[model samples]
Target: MNIPCPYCQHPITPGATTCPGCGTSLLREATPQSAEPTCGYHPRRLSLAICDRCGTFACAECLRLNSRQEVVCQRCHALEQDTPLPWDLREELGTFTAWWKTVVAVMFHPDTFPTFRPEGSAGESLLFAVLCAVPTSIVGGLSYMGFLSFVPYLLSSGNPSRDSVPSWLGPAMFVAIMILGPLLSAAYTVIQAGLDHLVLKMGGVTRGFQVTLRANAFSQAPWLLGAVPCIGPYVAPVWGLVARVFAYRGLHRTSWGVALAGCLVTPLLSCCLCGGIYLSLIRTLGGFN
Candidate 1:
């Protein structure tokens, strides 16, 4: 069994009084009791420690190290670790409400992200990404279809000679996109997560690809704001990138520099390469002229 040194989070050998890695003393005197009390969790065992927060009597088996490095009772530890986030309230609040609340929390209360238990698989993460992407993808697609279907007619309204796109084309395009767009977005999420995983690994994250994938998935929550008419296209991309940075920093338990480098480097490089290609194409076309 691997346990962490309370001071440095380095591995510690079991039953050791001092951390071999950090040389920090782990031995502590449990607050002495006048009379042996029954443990709160294990009634049969004599209490050896008292919870610093609640003053509950707990046996060795019922004691845990809390964030403050104080010995806490199992109940108190559970209270802190199991406080439900909005994401975990899906059944009670309904799917859309839960998702919206989660998005709001991620945007405004990012410190909560670190409290989120990272236990999901990559497929689960990608599915969440797909759901988040659907609203935006459909909204943007329909907006485009509307512009494509009606903008020409609006421009040519005064002229009777010009024709508008067939009425069937608009609904057809919208339907096709509503069906296919989410799938493509989910596929892209998988690819994007895999790419981000490489960068995160280089930055010293060892929690594996699923952690990165989940972070990437939750980051997509901001895109749901894209359903809010025209502003979404302009707003979601920038905010989503910011969210991803925080998500990585929290999920991987890494420094901000590592998180930012892992999250931004590949994307920035891709942008530079694409810009170069665009400039080269422009120069080639200019030469042809």
Candidate 2:
């Protein structure tokens, strides 16, 4: 007589104690039949081995039985337990837009933009922007007017002498530069600071207003190189490009769409504002005549 092996269903001699196909132990005596295997993922198989993480049962087909008897679903077991989800651009943009509104409001009133410190209010950032802009604009405007005077001196074919330049023109240019230049610089800086604040609030630590300002300052080095007459116009774009780079970096931390828009529009806006001022002054001086 012969019997079927319990492990591999192979036929064996009646006295055989193990399955030849799988090396599994055979019944020593006739035993009762057992139930079918159950799926590991199903909840009804509570008595079966289950995955420790996702809580799925283990069976011959569903079981990921390992040497240690530790079993888990293939999908859940392979996932990285510590990895965080990627940031959502839309959500970041929304947060940036909200922070932008706050910045605008604070610009109108210095009391609004808060500071990170205990004594600092929301307006501390705005205050810093104003302080930096005032001095930088004053110095920058004076330097620009001084540089412009060189054009006339060069045209006059005279050794550049400050005394020869018209005194009234210098003071007039100074006043004009002081009045318009600081306001423009202040506004631009405020906008940048606001954008940086927004980026911080949006869970981005890669870029900040201080970093942007430092980068801009470094980029302006090329503009000084623009002092070479014919090269001035060509090199001037470097300053504008630097500004756009800062803007794009800030936007990149927030949203790619916003960065794209900023890269296209910021230079144009700066040109319009600064150029309009320059052209207006020229017209007032009868340069159009």
Candidate 3:
């Protein structure tokens, strides 16, 4: 009689103990020769295997694969999919730490992309990018404020009156930076993500715009690196670019080549276009002079 191994679902001879396919200990006892059990869902059909989750008899039609690759009923499968990823636990874990772990995981483990559903609002994604920009902006702003406050003192030649900066200017700059930094960052993030989505469409990405936004948002997690004094500004952009490539590939379910083209082409084109405009403007002004 044909018997399937519980571990790997490989067909094996009846009365076998250890599964040759997966080497898992088949602690399963043989089914008794008594009356055949009916499926929990369809009473007319005979049960082939028991649902590992609910302990109910399941026919082949009712069998579904769980996260552990074990056989489960359709209800269990639906429930499992309905459960949230760690990234969605901001309410329980606090906003910064939750997104932080998600970012770290995405940067380190691109293969786990399948576990994330890439389902969130573009507005939500923009807000996330804005929040991620906060620490970086604060660090940079504080540095700028420090320079403004101290430059006059250091350059005074022991006289504070010469080239003195207004006391209110330093605090004013800090307040302005704190207020406008996140707003500007969020605006730029949204615009750039929209542009990236257009490029992604050109690359045959079929996922909706929301998914694209999510990928873009999560990829900007490296922006947190800008909190560092010297290298933060330099490293964050490069790190973000690399992360975006993987994020696009995973979220769009597209090839690496497509993801690369989508993520890089729009930004490169925009840079070239802006550079050309700047050069043209410079030449025009030089001619006028």
In terms of lDDT, which candidate is strongest? Answer: 3
Give per-residue CA lDDT, model 3, range 50-148, as digits (tens): 777688886655667765556777776675573344567889988777777887886687666655766776776787788788898787678778888
**What would the TM-scores of all predictions be?**
0.66, 0.28, 0.69
Worst 10 residues of 2 by lDDT: 111-120
> Candidate 2, residues 84-184: lDDT per residue as tens digits?
11111225556345334433332233221111111112233333334334444556567777876766667567555556566567557767866775466
lDDT of each: 0.76, 0.44, 0.77
TM-score of 3: 0.69
Tell me model 3's lDDT, rounded to 2 decimals.
0.77
Identify the runs in model 3 with alpha carbons over 4 angstroms from their true place.
Answer: 1-85, 155-164
Q: Model 1's lDDT to the true fold? A: 0.76
Of candidate 1, the 10-residue stretch with the lowest lDDT total is 27-36
lDDT of 3 at 262: 77
Q: How displaced is residue 79 in candidate 3, in Å?
A: 14
Candidate 1 runs further than 4 Å off:
1-85, 88-93, 148-164, 286-289
